[model samples]
Target: MKKLRYVKDEGMNKKRWLRGGVAICLSAAVLSGCATGQDKQGSQKDLANSLKVMYSGSEDYFYQEFGMLFSAVYPNIELEVVNTLSLENTLLDQYNQDMNKALDAFIEQEQPDVVLLDPTTITSLIENGKLYNLDTYVAEESYNVGGFNPGLHDYMKDIGGGQVYAIPSTFRSQALFYNKDLFDQYGVPYPTDQMTWDEIVALANHFPTDGAPSDRIYGLEMAWSKELTEVVNVLATAEGLNYFNSDTMQMSIDTPAWESIVEQSNQVLTSDAIFYYDYIYSGDYEASSESSLGDPFLEGRLAMKLESNYYIDTIEIAQNNAQDPEDIVQQWDMVTAPVGLQNPDSTGYSMFYNLFAINAASTNKEAAWTFISYITGDEFARVQSKQSYGNIPLRAQYFDKGDGRNYAAFYKLKPINNVPAYHQVPQRFVYEFPSMLQQEFASISDGQLTIEHALSELQIKGNELLATEIMSQEELKLYLQEQQDVLGPGVITR
Candidate 1:
């Protein structure tokens, strides 16, 4: 196994403050209820029991509301919900050191019962044995493990194994976010669930570019970096070209699937339908950008942008720039990514979200599990679906809400009916693989290098990184075996 590294410069100050906030919120809620100690005995027991959890937070209103609601239910639990400013800051401590000392120190000192870990952080924590194996917990409780999206569950289980280390809290998938006003102005058909990439291109080409500011409106835009590269990878995978071959332990960007990806990107870049000039590159997807594709889409300068459900919040925020923000977003809608001929079933997408896990060393294991169960349970899933404007539910029933009321819009936009099978196995190569491929692909997109050369070099450089910087094949096998021991034998396969 690879050596565990520590994050640096972590402080418990924010955590302390958040704990205080929860206490204050719960106290207010309890006092406002006017129910005495005897009347609220059961409630008090549920609330007063202390439990600590770590999460990522932003100005997103839903997160705050969820935290407050969680506190209200378990008044005694002393919910310590810490929101690290960003995934990178919390996980790598600004990349200051080879290790994550700061995060490690906090985990060691506070010993939070439950943690909301992102995929990147989950990878590190699982490797270090800092998280509990949740497989037994799920099986013993009959926790409806099969209720979530099979693809997403497989992705998590592959990473943390059958141990069920984490439960997905939310999901964000890439989709075509279009400006309704712009589509109407150009007399373009409103985006539908059945639209193909070629059809999207054709729609984009209908816009008149008559050398006027208004004529400059284009078809689509995407944030071109490691973050957005997942879209391309998803599309390629859907086309039947796996990025990594676990059996051969090799990267396969040299295949025709990869060629299809390059061709698709190139077509978009060089297309007359869109404005590919002044490409804005940001390492982080959620960063604030005045000229971001989202901004332009809101401004009516761009017709469509490829983004995730998380962008729905940003889109609402961006509407402040609009003369009529409400009407714009109300009319605005999203659709699944364009389909390909080879993988007619391919979704051309990927899902990103935060996962909730129990700490291996948590003092309050039962409390932690209770909290995890409560938040990720079917009840919470329904609440979350309503509160989080565009978040896709991981639970199957939530998606299957037959009336087409809750989260119906999101499920409608899903690219494929069947979940991709690749997510079922943890790809040891994911640690640094996506970012590496992103860099190479970006160069090719920018015309700095040919796709052929880039893929050839990527294969060689990727192999070197795997051999030297990543876990050896033997070590990976051992780790997989350990994961299976905790999760169960069927959690992973060779």
Candidate 2:
């Protein structure tokens, strides 16, 4: 067995953080040429090991999806899963309903061998030295890390302070899905990869916008949401704009760049070239069903749509179940998601939901590594590649959908930095800011306020919200006084 070193907690899993950083030592194991059950159980072939894993869903579901398959390969290992649903509920109650606090405590208490975490949670654990550095394990087992997406590996290394602490099972990315038949019919050229927002909007304007709501053929459709705010937010994020700066406790929404984006978004949203579903009329189920079951793109009424890889399955299902030849789309392909003008070569739409990590203090480290290695190995990718989970498998080679579509579009663009802006501020601000943005945009659309004025108001109100939520009375006074001295009086309302 290989011995590894980890941080020692002084109290009951309660320490500020490791000041000196984590300690890791190097070691190597003989390489396994094949990812077979016989090759993987080299050192532990004779011993029976029982392993516990922490999962988001129920144990039965995990077994049905993953555990069952894993057990079939390595029957010597017995698997048990601890569901996090009840754990989160109990922790939430104990920690005054503060989810971050609850999650911190949850990690300290639930010391399972293997656990699933989000990127932010993984970062927190890495900082606290609660996660084992997988560098040694990968080296000791001679695991091939090259098969996974290069971007996800880079992201993990960055967050883990140049040492790998976790590996993502799958990644979610957006792509530009266009109807080939619609483009040909409209005499418009097809959309291409790395096209900027301005270019996409220009392309969308080519189709004629002269017909009834149901009968109209829109040039562009955003399948995620029909709300204008969602569109603006997606566009702004692609441009690498951060709404709020947590360090300076400042808002960046009221800039000239933001005003320009608002204007462009308003023009595109109000134009007849785009399909903005009216939720008021959505009460009519029959009317909605006629419109590709709420997806205009599937009905061939849309020229292009921006959606995740999962939408492929939806389109495939629609095509198979079409009552008539025209009821569902027959021909469609995808390109990369729209790029930002600032960083045209990269995108921010790529993300991973399930990041697997091992506890630093687990007693069964060998068994845990075996499971992690098995799940992220070649055989696992080969098996999962056959199914459509609406996500890209880590090992891109095995990703075969049987059709030669542009599946590479999902991962063609290098990912822009994965630093989440929401993690910097209070969760309340993250939840509230979008609605606040929408309300101000509504005023602009109603002609009650200009774009510049709306953004200015948004900035001031956002500052006030942050002040009340993040600072004490005395601190707020000092902050406001400093702000007034820099700018002018009446900039920040009391």
Candidate 3:
């Protein structure tokens, strides 16, 4: 019975964030051999156990394909899969409710052995104790926690209260993808993994300003206009900018970290070197188009762009299906994404992570761990990495293969500790606050507001929103009472 901490407010249940930074102890568990489950090496009978799995994202391809792979490995073990629907899209209210009901009913009736959920749904599942704590099995088998991306292991620990509730099976992080052919033509040295945004911007302007009449070309393209939130997030996260004060709960945008991000953003906004991709929804990601505003790299219009591993399949598809394969991405390569001025570990931006966990109330706990261990093993990672499933395997070595080429550097960069509220608030406020402040950002970009005015406006408005969000018990009561007083006894005469 671990002491699990949770947010007290019912509406804000999504705020399952860890307060104060804590070093990962699971790594210690791995070394100390401190786990407690029966280390049962299994036979065909153990392998014959039937397991239920819930896949939160993907419907048609991922599950159907993985089912075959899992079957080939353990011929006797049966996998029953149910998809609650993809979480990649903006969750609609009715859809959210329906999916919630389906999952709730599934868990209640089926009592699944394993659950494959995304980060967005894990919070709710964790609160309900649908996922099991994996400490015992991990310790008993000496499961190496250090094998995972550093920050993600920390995140799992925080989510599970010093235990392991979920493991990230797939992940995709932003990287600095460059065109070697373009760089060669310009005689500009390839971008280094450690280069800063400021440094990259300088390099982007090095190529010829003039180009062919039909398609435009640029030295570098961050596509920041499409991923503005990520752009802002990476820069601010590097400086460890938590949006609000823990004691006061007041939002503070006055920090030097925020200032640095704004300055960097302004540099990009002013440079005209970036390509502003369209903001079409995520569902249209695979559809054919002119690389959308979000992907100048894919259309061969730009030398470089910062993007996630998901882009690899898209580029491969474009190359394989194109009339000419050599021209697509034209000798493309990637390096670790640039770190911010504050945290120089070369980590920032976002990564789409897929999670796996044993159901907390499962009947076949031991056999379930057996299945969980095998599928998440390095061999499975290797197999899955080469597939067209679009999931980037967690282990780096899986990307080590291929024609002396593509994805050689995939594992070189590490995942960042995504600061949930970076400001000690919930993600809704963090995302919303940034969006609201976009007006000021636009003001700065459009030259309507000076940097000073923009900063002041962002601070003032951001604080007001934060105040509303973090209202104290007393504050809430007073506010409600004030509203009641305004109504003045219901006006019976009316």
Candidate 4:
């Protein structure tokens, strides 16, 4: 049994040492290899094989990040990564009605045993019976997946129409990072788990906002830019309100729910307690702030900011680069991202990007299953946890990086049931809609337009924009098919 280790933030030596230890443990447990198909009674004799994998990145990168570690445990099984950049580019070049035909040809020619796909592509393939079902394999091996994030397996099963077709080794999540010292200095209480958006804003209002532009302390900073629309979008997403209806191809931003969100967001934006990195440094202090350092939160000025798990990497890098001990963000921790008032138990800020699945047409199902199982296993997650900065491990225990910090905050809330409606809308619509919103919001902020009149005007303008940009159903289908490769492998194919 493996026990967790405590890691100090003064240096990254412990992280490096632990990663090295994980490699050693993997070598010692070579025969087990997560006890997938390769380790079974009759499978071991036939384990010597070369497995082909389709990945979005270069072969060297795949080998460096994953292939090397896997080889340490399964020396006989050769891992071949089939880089799809060229194939993806070719698909992107000629995007039309025959896009699926071209994709089919590419798949037949490549015949990769395993493939890394986006969630949307995974769903499409699952629907078309082009992906293998892993439920039978999982049940046969009695694989214990109870350690994964809550509802994650069920989420995948739902995507695959009641069967598990793909698995993600890691996911992306955001949390509310607060500076403990700032809270203590301002005599404000620390934020807790499952906070509602309104509750968070109310708490932020408690902090004093009087000071110079550069030296001021802010209660909250939700985004890097001063875009009120961006902050409003976050709040609206938490509330499960679709500002655009994909099926109808119309704007839904004028609704009461949206109106309320905009009103609240406007209040927060006008309040001096909220900080926008761009706004703060746009004037005389711009040079000083830029010269002083990176990340005001790290600079010990911002009270709290809702940021992604990647922020940990930023913090670690700051600590490593700090020439003076005083420059470090000495005390900080995180809590769950803000939720909606009605649904305070879940958040919409979580996403799984790299989904691994076995090709149903492959003759090497055994080997492919072994590879997939190994990558998604608890042991693999343990090693990967220390290696990656932005990715949240699928396994529950590994979330605790032994750093004695509140790692649980990243995974504390259940993911919202629905994917964002914007994903389903046309790509052009999604890209252009935000600008229209911002223009109208700017008018309201300048006191030239009332909220009611502004929303009404927005609804009219948005419909016109949608009408001009909308593609026919069949055309939309072909467009999505052709553009998947162009958007890169990580794009969600909603």
What TM-score do all the candidates reach, one by one? 0.59, 0.79, 0.67, 0.80
Under the 3 Å rule for N, CA and C atoms, how many clashes does model 4 have? 0
Greater TM-score among 2 and 4 belongs to 4
Report the Cα lDDT for residue 380, model 4: 69
Order by lDDT, highest first: 4, 2, 3, 1
- Global lDDT scores for all candidate models: 0.57, 0.69, 0.58, 0.70
TM-score of 3: 0.67
Give Cα distance to truth, residue 217, candidate 1, Å: 3.9
lDDT of 2 at 225: 45
Expressed as tens digits, the lDDT of each residue in 85-125 for candidate 1 is: 44333434333322344456657756667776655456567
Model 3 spans with C-alpha error above 4 angstroms:
1-42, 57-62, 82-110, 117-131, 139-155, 158-162, 211-216, 224-252, 278-301, 350-352, 406-408, 419-435, 446-453, 463-494
Give the poorly placed runs of model 2, Cα more than 4 Å off.
1-43, 46-48, 96-101, 138-142, 223-227, 246-250, 279-291, 325-327, 417-432, 468-494
What is candidate 2's lDDT per residue for 1-494, written digit by digit as tens? 11122121223111221111111100001011124556546667654488888899878657644676577667688998977875555776565544556666776786788878777566667777778999887665457777676566677787677988987776778889999998999889999999987788789899988876656778987523455576778788677777777557688888987877777777667656876545214442123243245566776778988877777766765566666746788888999899888788778877766778888888887788878887787777776555433446777777656587788888777666555534346444654566678888888878899988988988998887766444333544576678688757865442
Once fitted onto the true fold, the runs of candidate 1 whose alpha carbons sit more than 4 angstroms away are 1-48, 54-67, 80-112, 119-163, 179-189, 194-196, 223-251, 277-296, 299-301, 314-330, 339-352, 359-363, 378-450, 465-494
Number of the predicted model whose TM-score against the real structure is largest: 4
Candidate 2 structure lDDT: 0.69
Per-residue lDDT value at 20 in model 1? 44
Question: Per-residue alpha-carbon lDDT of model 4 for 1-494, expressed as tens digits?
Answer: 11212222323643443454555544544434444424544644576388999888878657645676677556667888887765555643444323344345556678889978766455556666778888988675445678787768777786677888888765878899999998999789999988887788888888887877566777887855666677788787777776666557787788787788889888777666777656644552331232124356777888888887877876775676667646767799999898888677777887776788888899889888777777777766776766643467788787776777788877777766456434334455554556667888888888898888888888887787767643544666676666675665546333
